[model samples]
Target: MADENQGFMGAVWETIKTIFWALIIAGVFRTLFFQPFWIPSSSMKDTLLVGDFLFVNKMAYGYSYASCPNIKIARFGIDIDADDICGFLDGDNTRVLAGEPERGDVVVFRHPVTHQDYIKRLIGLPGDRVQVKEGLIYINDEPVKVEDGGTFTEVKEAQGPERRFPRCSNDPVGEGGQCVKERQIETLPNGVTHSTLNITDRGDLDTTKVFTVPEGEYFFMGDNRDNSTDSRVAQTSFGVGFVPYENLIGRADRIMFSSAGRSMLFFWTWRSDRFFKGIE
Candidate 1:
């Protein structure tokens, strides 16, 4: 009887040790190499969807110990980035390496005001002059070329009582009311191309003053032009203004999977086409 009890105790201890090692390994990998991020909004619409799951390459910009501790562990109840906006380095904490994002990269960063993580396309780099005129992007006084794609329609099955949803004038003049948006292909100066949604042509954000990116800051914008509150608006106005270099967490590498917010058990809700899709 004593031998049986000892055997059971030994097995339990071994199981605990195995679980501990597994967690440590996963945590280390997530901290140093990559971590997953989920898209919860339509800000990146055509490029990314509301239910898209992406693998953010943390190593893309190196690791800085001066950055705030991972929220999962720190439990600070704050959404701030690990690093200070000014890139201040703690005496004992140093950057593990160095890397920088290019103009067309899609990055995840911490918002200055809300301190929440946001993903957007990098539009303006340091010292670049950026502006929007008549729903077009102008960088350094040169217009970024755009090709007309066509209209994009969003279909939904009403879950509750019918409600009215305000829509852009250009939306298909549907008798029953439909959600529609204009789609266009945007070509960046670096030749990288992506699609953008233009819900309206004359909204307040369609035209803006020229923004000269500061020495160490960057400007990002969402693909859903008319809906996203991005760098186009001033930080004081509750928008994500110029982002600092240190606020960047990682570059979005690829979409690992997607769902339509329905139960995972419902296989029909799985967006199979988006699985393992590469973000342009």
Candidate 2:
């Protein structure tokens, strides 16, 4: 009886160790190479939909200290704070052999004011004069070539907490209402083309003053024009404006998986068409 009890306890201990090591390895890989992110809003609409799960490549953009999590915090490694970590830390210029963000790259960064995670397309780079006039984007005084892609209608139901999202909706008018939007393909100066949705040609953000992206700052905007509160809004107004280089976390590489968000156990809501889809 004693021998059986000891064997059972040893087996449990071994299982626990195995799980712990597996989690540690996974966490290290996620931290160093890629991080998974979910689209929770309609800001990116036609490009990246709600419930889309994507992998952000950490190595694509150079890493700051804030991008690297403290491994010591997990109690798996030794603690070594460069600036004396006291339960909180700020951005430190710690480049770990990575590249810089480029124009038209979809990036994830920490919000300059809220410190929350946000993903948007990199628009105006350093010193770029960006402006939106009558629903058209002009970079450096040259209008971005935009071609009509026809109309887009959202026919799906909202899932998770996004059901309460009071932005552009599938049922725009009301229940059983038609949600129609104008679709257009906008080509950036770098030739990176992505589709955009416009509820109307004349919306609040559709007309804006020329934004001169300052040095060491990048401007970001959502593909869902008229709906997103991005670089178009003032930073002091609680909107993301001219994100610093240090705030960038990574570049969104591809969509790993996506769901319709009706149910987790129900497999019918899975967006199989988006599985392993590459993000443009």
Candidate 3:
């Protein structure tokens, strides 16, 4: 009986050790290489969907305080933010072994004030003047090229875990009906082109004052121009303003998986085409 009990206890210890090591390795991997992200809104529209799942390439722009993983489990009463792990690196707005991010790059960063993670396209770099006029973007007094790309359509139904309904240019859409938004292809000064969606002809953000991006900061905007509350709005208003360099977490390069249902276990809702789909 003693031999049998000893053997069982030995197995339990081995299992516990294995799990502990596995978690340690995963934490290191997530901090140094890639961190998984899920799209929870339509801000990026056709580029990223509500259920799109992708890994942020942490090495794409090197490491910063924002590179540290923010773990928050309310039920467990656990809340660990980036500052908790790398507070010493904060406030400097610098990154170790950093590479410059180009205009039009889709990036994920921590909100300057709230410290919450947000994903958007980099629009203005340091010392650039950015503005939106009549739903068109202008950089340093010159407008970027915008070409009509037709309409983007989706079902007018609650989506994802949030159960949020998509805003549409053609409103009054009944549930299960087709919701549409006008799509336009925008080309930045660097010649990078991406699709932007318009839900209304006149949106509050369609026309805004020229915002001069300060040095060591960046301006970002959502692809869903009308629906996004981005750099166009001030951070004090609960919108993402100019993000500091240290706040940038990483770049999003591709979608590894996606699901349209509330739970990922609902295999029938999986989007097969989005598997390994590269983000442009």
Candidate 4:
């Protein structure tokens, strides 16, 4: 009987060791290779949508302090930010084996002041002057090419887990009605073209003063245009100002999976078309 008990105890110990090592491997893989990111807002509409789930390529721009995972689960009262894990690497604004990001690449970076993760399209590189005038972007006094791409339409209803309703150029749209926004294809100086949405012709951000990006910093903007609070607004005013290179976490390459419903568990709401869709 003693022999039987000893054998059972040995088996349980082995099982525990296996489970422990499995968790360690997963944690290392997530930290060093890829980190999962879910689109929680409509800022990158038409390119990325709410409920879209993708893994950020941590190795694309190499490792930085911002590459550390920031886990925040409100229900569990657990909040661990990237700074908490890699604060030693912060302040220097440098990445190990850093790679330069292109002008039009969609990037994920930590807010300089808030330290929160934000994803937007790179607009201005270091030492570049960026400005918006009459709903058009001007880089170094030269207006980038913009062509009308007709209207983008969607249902006027609560979307995703936040249940937020989308804004429309044709406002006053009732629930379940068609919400519309003007779409325009913008070609950057580097010839990278992407669709941008405009909800209003005369929004506050439609025109802005010339912002000369500082050395080692970058300017970013959202594809949603008037809806996003990005580099156009200063960090002191609660917007993402110029982001430093080290704050960059990674690049978003593609959408691995997407759902339209409030919860991902609702399999019927899955968007199969967006599965494995490459981000332009």
Global local distance difference test of model 3: 0.93
**How close to the true structure is residue 145 of candidate 1, measured as C-alpha lDDT?**
91
Ranking by lDDT: 3, 4, 2, 1
Give the backbone clash total of model 2.
0
lDDT of 3 by residue, 1-280 (tens): 9999999999999999999999999999999999999999999999999999999999989999999999999999999998998999988788999999999999999998888889999999999999999999999999999999999999999999999999988889999999999999999999999999999867889999999999999999999888887899988649888989889999999999999998788899999999999998
Which candidate should be chosen as best, given lDDT against the real structure? 3
Sliding window of 10 residues with minimal summed lDDT for model 2: 80-89
RMSD of each: 4.5, 4.4, 0.9, 1.5
Assess every candidate by TM-score.
0.83, 0.86, 0.98, 0.95
Pairs in clash, predicted candidate 1: 67-82, 67-83, 68-82, 68-83
Where model 3 places Cα greater than 4 Å from the true spot, the runs are none
**Global lDDT for candidate 2?**
0.79
Tens digit of lDDT per residue, candidate 1, span 1-280? 9999999999999999999999889867777778778777777878997778888888887765423334543576664454443246533323457688898899987776666778999999999999999999999999999999897776532211222232444554554455778989999999989999988888999999999999767999999898788999888537899987766778997999987653345567788999999998
Question: Residue-wise lDDT of candidate 4 within 116-139, one digit each (tens)?
Answer: 888999999999999999899999
TM-score, model 2 to reference: 0.86
Q: With candidate 3 superimposed using the best TM-score fit, by how many Å does residue 79's alpha carbon deviate from the native?
A: 1.3
Off by over 4 Å in 4: 1-8
Local lDDT at 132 for model 2: 95
lDDT of 1 at 65: 41
RMSD of 1: 4.5
